[model samples]
Target: MKAAVLYARNDIRVEEKAVPALEPHEILVKVKATGICGSDLPRVLGDAAHHYPIVLGHEFAGVVERIGFGVSKVKVGDRVAGVPLKPCFKCQDCLSGNYAQCKYYSFIGSRVDGSWAEYVAIPEINAIRFDDSIRFEEAAFVEPSAVALHALQHIRFEGGENVAVLGGGNIGLLALQWAKLLGAREVTVFDIDDDRLASASRLGADHTINAKHPDVEEQVKRMTDGKGFPVVLETAGSDVTMRQSFELAASKAKICFIGTPAGDITFSHKQFELMNRKEFTLTGSWMSYSAPFPGREWELTLHFLKQGKLNFKELIFRTFPLDEINEAFDLYRTPGAVKGKLMLLPG
Candidate 1:
């Protein structure tokens, strides 16, 4: 198998490696399509610490080629998408249906070798079978879609509520669409890049604001009749945008932090007090839950896609072969080039 292996900071190489052996409860998947996420950028740039000589990718969909002895959920020729987090079901957090919070949780593409290769072996429990109608390229979006769904579940918004999203990237765009689907009366997206803002407009955002504008806060306030947005989702992981999120939120509003800053942030204590005085709720949203049953956010995301309620196909900006993995990362680093999502196909 050929894979893009990360050896050091900005040192990824395409090399041949032995095919991964399947565990008793795991299944082997023939990699079809994988999406590059923002989280992968840190490891690619050598800023974030990660195990060297690792294959990186988690947002993916593929066909099952072989199954472990006990696998029953999927069989050969099945197309599937899955949650990357592998958790011990007996743990307290997992028992309580908070798998993301489980102490024994580890994710593929991060803690272990992942989808950047021709094949990967994942536990049968993590896989979700998709109908033949869903294309592999679109299936690659299931992971991010699940994250957007998780964030939506964490926040409380009323129908016809005004909402603002702070970024125009893949997650932000997905958030905007989900907001609309969930009955937001108006959706606004903010970004410094005009290209992304334009893409946001095409994807259901009622309005797009260039945060680079001098009166960005005032613009948001004016749109909301000076009351500010009832809900604000900060997806632009930057200190500047984080502070701006505080300024643009309405009193008694809810704000969800979906993006992480590259460094620490410092804000005035008075601003912290403002949140309390305004009775605002500030929440941090992580990845989707990995538990079973009714609140299965990942399952709901796939359902939405299957029903044509979530339009992921239009959001794909480009697709590259696995051999061009370095070029894919380079394109991802180039600002304003990717309008939505970029996929890597293992040909």
Candidate 2:
């Protein structure tokens, strides 16, 4: 087996490694297409990884090469996407069907060796079988797509109200589509990058706003006729976007924070008071998981992809072979050097 192992911050290397041994109910997948996630950047370049000498990649799709004892969900030769969350079923949160809140959780690509290799072993329950209509490249997006859907699910949105998505990056774009697909009257996407904004437009965003503009707030107010959006999704995790979420919500709105903050976040009094004044519900969403283990997020993602309702390929910016893993990480060294998704082809 071959893998891109992260020895330390900025020290990832492509090296030979032993193939993972499968346990009962586990499946060995021949890695096909794996997408680099935003969370992976910090682990490879910053001090966010839990351990050294790790193979990092969770968003992936592959073919089942072999199955362990007792595996029944998928058979050998099945095309599948991997679900990365492995929750302690004994935890109180897990017992309550809140898998995402499990006190003890082992995440692939973070807590263990993951899909950034020619072969990886995962639980049979984590192997989601997608329709053959869905390409391996498209199946690679199931993780992030499920993430965006999970954020929306936190609000229990039964749409029709105007929705605002405060980011045009990968997650934000997916959230925008989910908003529209789930029946939002209109969906608006905001970002500082024109390239991202343009993507939003192409993907059916009712409106796109450049947050870098001096009149961003004014434009937002004008578009909503001063009422602001009734549903706001903050997917940027930047201080600016997090604060703007407060400034952009309508009274009695529902707001979900999907993106994880990278540093200390300081909010102004006015921004903090908006929650009280507007009586808007503010919730923070964690990893995408719910009842029945991997849950509806992953299932519905594949459903939509199979139905051709979701845009998967459009979000991809580039792809690299596993041997060129070092060069791929170097692309992230320069801020904004890459846009959309960067896929790794292990085959």
What is the C-alpha lDDT profile of model 2 across 1-347, one tens digit per residue?
Answer: 99999999999889999999999999999999999999998998899999998999999999999999999889999999999999989978999889988879899999999999999999999999986898899999999999999988878999888999998989999999899899999999999999999999999999999988899878887999999999999998988889889999999998899988899899988789999999998999987898887889999988888788999888999999999988888888878888888999999
Q: How does model 2 fare in lDDT?
A: 0.92
Query: What TM-score would every model get versus the actual structure?
Result: 0.96, 0.98
Once fitted onto the true fold, the runs of candidate 2 whose alpha carbons sit more than 4 angstroms away are: none
Model 2 error, position 188 (Å):
0.7
Number of colliding residue pairs in model 2: 0
- Candidate 2: residue 291 Cα off by (Å): 1.0
Clash pairs for candidate 1: none
Task: List candidate 1 stretches off by more than 4 Å.
Answer: 293-295
| Worst 10 contiguous positions by lDDT, candidate 1 | 289-298
- What C-alpha lDDT values do all the predictions have? 0.85, 0.92
